[model samples]
Target: MRSIITISREFGSGGREIGKKLADDLGIPFYDKELLEMASKESGICQELFVKNDESYTNSFLFSLVMGNYPVSADGRINPDMPLNHKIFLAQFETIKNIAKKGPCVIVGRCADYVLKNEPNIIDFFISGNTAEKKKRILERYDIEKNKAEDFIRKTDKRRASYYNYYTDMKWGEAKNYDLCINSSKTGVDGAIKLMKAYIEIKEANADK
Candidate 1:
């Protein structure tokens, strides 16, 4: 139960729900949009700005270079002199690191898998589902027509992929990048959670030995 989990999920796949349930089952904190709020609070940026710039591939390369890394205290606390946007990025990045330090939380999206790549006790998961199942879920959850659901699914997944691929060196949703890739449509959300729990147990046990 003491393992950081990063979940990268396809749109309409119920990835967020599974992450929440898994964290509850393990008695650990679950973070999603909470990450953005924390970042906003620390950096004095609006939540909308954080969301918009998050893992955004469109961020100007020159801007990122010019901004560079924000100053941090000797103890790694953020320095106050950095620009607002850099401060926001640093805050969210620090949140990811701090969450891992606190142990055993399920973090959703925001390229979390990449952010905490150096951590030893991490299990990254990519959740996806069949096209028909995903489309149905999107339609029902979003209250959209079938055609809109299909288009939404495609566009959303593309955005996620771009964000992930741009931020991380690895390909998004590739089997090798994640410790486990689950198709929730096969066994439903609860079943996927059970499978993940079992898998984590095995990995933990082997690591302990």
Candidate 2:
């Protein structure tokens, strides 16, 4: 309960629900889309921009060239002339760090694991499920037709993977990058939550020793 937890989940994996429930059970704050609001407030940027770019990456060569020459302020403020996408990213990055500094909480997606990688009390998790189960889950949760669920799931996962890979040195959904990897298809949502809680207990106990 003393460790900040960051969850990177595949589409239709139930990762957000697990993170929210776990945080509630542990009496800690939960952050997912809420991070966007915080970053908007912190950076004086519009929240709509963050929502538009949420968990998505842009690969514009021109923007990269421009950002390279963009001068950062001596006080470490983001350059106003930087691309909106990069500004939104930096805002979220700083917001994640500030949230971690506040206390232990559960954060879902948006490359929070990489944002807080150097923190002493951070636990990172990657949640994934088998393709069939994920598609079924997606069909149940969203209004999409059963025939299209698979494609929807695939596209969503691809977008998330691209975003994570673009921002972090680690590969998305790679086991070595996370402290624990949960297969929600095998364990179910409640089971996964239980496993995470037990792991947290052991980690905190070991840290105390």
Candidate 3:
């Protein structure tokens, strides 16, 4: 089952849960927060920096890129003066590529679909759902107050969209950007999973043939 699956999702769309279940069922690794952990360890950059920049744009890109490589490269070893945000992004880019090299796995968010865009064995998906359904899911799942659910979903989705657009050439959540776009509100999680499983199985079978 040589495939790398990346899920791009709306804030409350159940995309992460779907990715986790897919990895488990496929007996593969699921990466979401794990990517940050690896990046921090390998790059010597603080984990908080990566978390702070995750799925969001940084104003310091050009200036930081001008700085060299790492903002705090005191050892005369690092890039000497890289933008903090760019350093974080570079670390993640390398980590994403390294992870893909390890084998077939499921990756969630972090613009992973864009990171692995060149791989032929990749399957990309974008998960979205109706506003009502998403708000309910966020409220229940995060225990967010009922009154705050609407704003929560809107703001989060906006951030994700901005992040993706800033880092990649494509528009976020656009149907043309993904191989499959599932509205989890109608199909539900299990049904959507079933659809993807069938899709991949067919692809694998065709490849074998």
Candidate 4:
């Protein structure tokens, strides 16, 4: 009930839905796309840039070499010359920390688990589903052909994995990296949320003792 929850989810896995509902039921704030807006405002960067780079990282080594690392000078100010992608990430990193300071909330994706790794009251979850279930979910939510849904899901998950793996030392979807790994296909969204709530309650109670 008093933990900052971070959810890393596979494409079409109902992760965002679970995070929002969990926050609502717990009377805490939920952040997903809303984090992008806050990042834009905080960094004075265009919102479009954050959306474009959100949850996906650049894979080209040459491009990264040209852009250089996300740098902070001795004064602790981010270098003006840092790449746009890095800038967006830094913005999100700062925004996530700022949001956590406000209180317990559910944050979805964006390597939030890594960003807040050192912060207290952190609980991370990874949500995944079987390929068939994910494809069905994608087909229903998006106006795409049934034949293309599987490919779409595969590509989207690849991008997310690349993003997360690039940002954090831990592998995405790895069971050990998360406090709990839920297969939404088996339990469904409501069941997954219930499980998370139960886990958080137990964790909080143990902490108090």
lDDT of 3 by residue, 170-207 (tens): 89999998889999999999999999899888888888
In candidate 4, residue 48 scores what lDDT?
Answer: 93
lDDT against the true structure, per candidate, is 0.82, 0.87, 0.85, 0.87
The collision pairs in model 4 are none
TM-score for every candidate vs. truth? 0.87, 0.91, 0.89, 0.92
Candidate 2 differs from the real structure by a C-alpha RMSD in angstroms, to one decimal, of 3.1
TM-score of 3: 0.89
Rank by TM-score (best first) = 4, 2, 3, 1
Instruction: Indicate the residue-level lDDT of 63 in model 2.
Output: 29
lDDT of 1 by residue, 161-192 (tens): 88677655679999999999999999799999
Q: List the residue pairs that clash in candidate 1.
A: none
For model 4, how does the per-residue alpha-carbon lDDT over 6-83 read when each residue is reduced to its tens digit?
Answer: 999999999999999999999999999999999999889999998988887874422232234445687878777877
lDDT of 4 at 193: 96
lDDT of 2 at 64: 39
Question: Residue-wise lDDT of candidate 2 within 1-209, one digit each (tens)?
Answer: 68999999999999998899989999999999999999999999999999999988885322232235434777876567777777777788779989999999999998888778779999999999999989987888889988889889999999999888876667999999999999999999999999999999999999999
Judge candidate 1 against the unseen true structure and give its global Cα lDDT, from 0 to 1.
Answer: 0.82
RMSD of each: 3.4, 3.1, 3.8, 3.4
